[model samples]
Target: MTAETCENGPLRRFLTVSNKLAALGAIGVSIGFVIVIWVQNNHTRSLLYETELQDSIRMTEVIAAQLYGPLRWRKPSIAQDTYDSMITHRDLHVVAAVTLDRQGNVVTTYQQNSSQPFNFQELRLNAGADLRLDSTWTAELDGKLVVATPVTSHDGRKPAGTFVVAWSLAEIDRAMRAMFLRAAFITIVLFAAFTTLSLAIVHRQLSDPLTQLTQATTRIANGDKTFEIPCTDRRDEVGDMARALVTFRENVALIDRLTAEQQQQTLRLSNALEKEREYNALHREFVSMVSHEFRTPVAIIDGAAQRIERRVGKDTEDQLRERTGKIRSAVVRMIELIDSTLSVSRMEAGTIELEAAECDFAALLREVCQRQQEIAKHHKIDLTIADLPSRILIDAKRMDQVLTNLLSNAVKYAPDAPDIAVKAGTVGRNVVVSVRDRGLGIPEAEMPKLFEKFFRASTSAGIPGTGIGLHLVKHLVELHDGNITVDSTEGKGSTFSVTIPTRYGEADAAASAALSA
Candidate 1:
């Protein structure tokens, strides 16, 4: 397997000068726009008020001119009435008057009934401060303007009176309102134009590039390696980003292709490794089985040959014959063990054929127990099967192998204990078979590896074993759609159980048929 490689990760930073400047510029422009609008509004208001004040002062001078001659001054009613009526017609709401005293007092005054009341007191006191219409009063009395002048009776002799005039500032107010409305409209139009231009610029330079990059990233995440981000011609910050994004996406595409190839390579390597491991296991088991099966017989044959050579006398002939019989038994044992191991291998390699004819498990257990008992007699151990009626469907040959393996192991591992129990029962819809031994039990740590090919328990380290017996048994059980497991304790004992589906009926007849195998 190839080791995974590492790479330096990219650091995405959020802080940048152009972004900061854009934020500051936006705030600055908004504030500046508001200031410009305020100044324009105030200037227009000032112009409107000043023009109205100037117009009022010119009209006041015209009224003062009427008092310059005796004819106009002596009978001042006609001139005063004419000017006052003209002022009224102009919708000025003005008061025209002449004073007959030198103390700037209101001696005689003319007023229209509809004009706003003005403060004559302040106008009389402040009239002579400066002559070019210096005294002008606001609506201090009651929403009115007061204009005052000192009169000398138009003869430079009769310090007649101070003229006091009152007028409404409604026209001045109207002019100011119109100016404000016009300025507001202009300000709104300019802001609208500026906002539209700013939005367009943002859309072209910022939004468009970002949207493209976002789409590219989405495509890349969805396993598309052919995503192409368009480049920007802008020279500002967005252009730098567009260049970086396109380059990064190209690199990611290359990495994606490499990663896919690497994944396939890794899968192939993993499969190759698993096949090699299985091959090694089977080869090792074959070599071990050959060694075990040949060693005992070879030793017996060599002993018999040497005994015949040593037994030249008449008393040694019987011993020589006995040794030859022992060697014959050893040879038969070797042949049986070799055949069993080879059968297991053929089954593992998928060459074993199962003739799934009807059979009985109870009778199968009896035959296996009788065989196990015969084998245990050689080691001075006892084997017994729990009583059960033969009533099931099974492959008798395959089940014999499973039971033989378990019984052989129990007797081999627990030679001194001698007691082995074979059991058969039904659990739910399945037939349950168990072989238990009161022997030198398996260690806790080695129990899980018992069904692994060529794996021997720690206690069986010095024992004669090819170690493929349990593995073959487990595989055979699974091929029958069954399960096998063991419960064991290190100094106590072990029980191996196999469960498979049970078919009802055909006990005695099926047992007789399987007995032929």
Candidate 2:
């Protein structure tokens, strides 16, 4: 509503929502892409395993056929070069034989890792026919593929039992290594190409538009609105989102500007209302204080004036003097209240200074107790005092004010209960003085701010108080380098404790001096 508020441009919209959307899209795509790769890798490995199985089986069949048939079951013989060739074969690592009787065994073995020797014995006895393969054993240092097969010798067309061969697993391991390396290399090359092309596509379709949006948002934050983002013709979600965002930003800026103006108007109204209320409160306090102070004195003056006017008709001269003395007492009480008000004002404005002196605290408490006892008797409130031997150095008048304010507050707050206590003792190198009252106590939550100016108890609404008593007490106590603490429970009672350090503790000062020596 003001010209000053209008000078600031449109309010800015937060664009973090856009970054979040992009991040969500990127995360979803990455997870899907990883799952696809894992499935593809599993399928490739399965295919490789099956291919190796078929190839190994076929090679076993071809190699086994070169051995004996059932007709040569008893005796077997083969040429040395023939045995040597089978032993040194590229794909096969061993050749060996065993009789159907468990004691007969012979082997043309490869010079490598050992094969399981029981195969020929076990296989010849178990199916008793064509044995295409025995088993493979892998080498420890370098994988050497080994297999065994039974062989037979043909002599005059007679039958012989078996011949067996042992072989290494080198070729199988080599093929597996090759397959894995190929898959890894191909996968890496394809992934690099895919990522590079995808990044370039994204740069074309997305990054440029997003960059423009970002710059426009920054300009908006800096209170600029003359520039605009170029709208694209693409009919995708991104294009729709860009259009929506531009519209949203336009609407939000207008609403925010209007809201700012409304806030300014509300602040001005609030300040004006606050000042008016403060003026009313000050006027009300002035009237109440002046009236309370002036009421009794005005009454006494009116009664005295009426008496003096009637003295010529009915009264003796001494009776007239007695009435005049009553008027003087009322005036003195009024003067005391006025002085209390003025002293509080001076304390608040930092115009009051202490007349500090090194006085015995014990002697001061004796005097305070003597004076308070007479007042307590009139109010029917018992005043108990104890532990007054502890001494401290402080301003006598200020210390007296602390005790007086606390006593008055307790009496005022607990008039019906009628019991009040004052206790003082040495706690470490400090003296602790406590005022305890059994009365309507303070709430726990209100205890902390009890010493703050103008704060009153929740239950004390009808009570006559200025709410400055505790505030003045706190300042006076602290001026003597003491701290005051309170503990209270609702409906029970309250205690106010003040602790001030000793001016000279005989034991402590002597210990410190001895240590220095």
Candidate topping lDDT:
1
Residue-level lDDT tens digits of model 1 in 24-118: 55556656877886787788767766776676666665555454442324555654565556565666656534433444444445556536564
TM-score of each: 0.49, 0.42
lDDT of 2 by residue, 1-517 (tens): 3112223243322223443445455555555666675676667656754555445544543444444442233223443334445444453434332333223333222233345444544433332345433433222212322333333332223223233333334454566567656666666666556555655566567776766665665666666656665554558866776677677668768987899999999998999999788756855775585675477567887888888887766777788877787677566546545655666688779887766666788777666655555444434334344554444566777777777667767776776777778787777767788888887889988887788765678755555666666777787777666799998877777899988766534455589999999
- lDDT, candidates in the order shown: 0.66, 0.59
- Which numbered prediction scores highest in TM-score against the true structure? 1
Question: What C-alpha root-mean-square deviation, in Å, does candidate 2 show against the real structure?
Answer: 23.3
Note the residue pairs that clash in candidate 1.
99-160, 99-161, 100-160, 100-161, 101-160, 101-161, 139-144
Off by over 4 Å in 2: 1-283, 286-290, 293-336, 372-385, 389-391, 504-517
lDDT score of residue 361 within candidate 2 = 84
Model 2, residue 73: distance off in Å is 99
Worst 10 residues of 2 by lDDT: 137-146
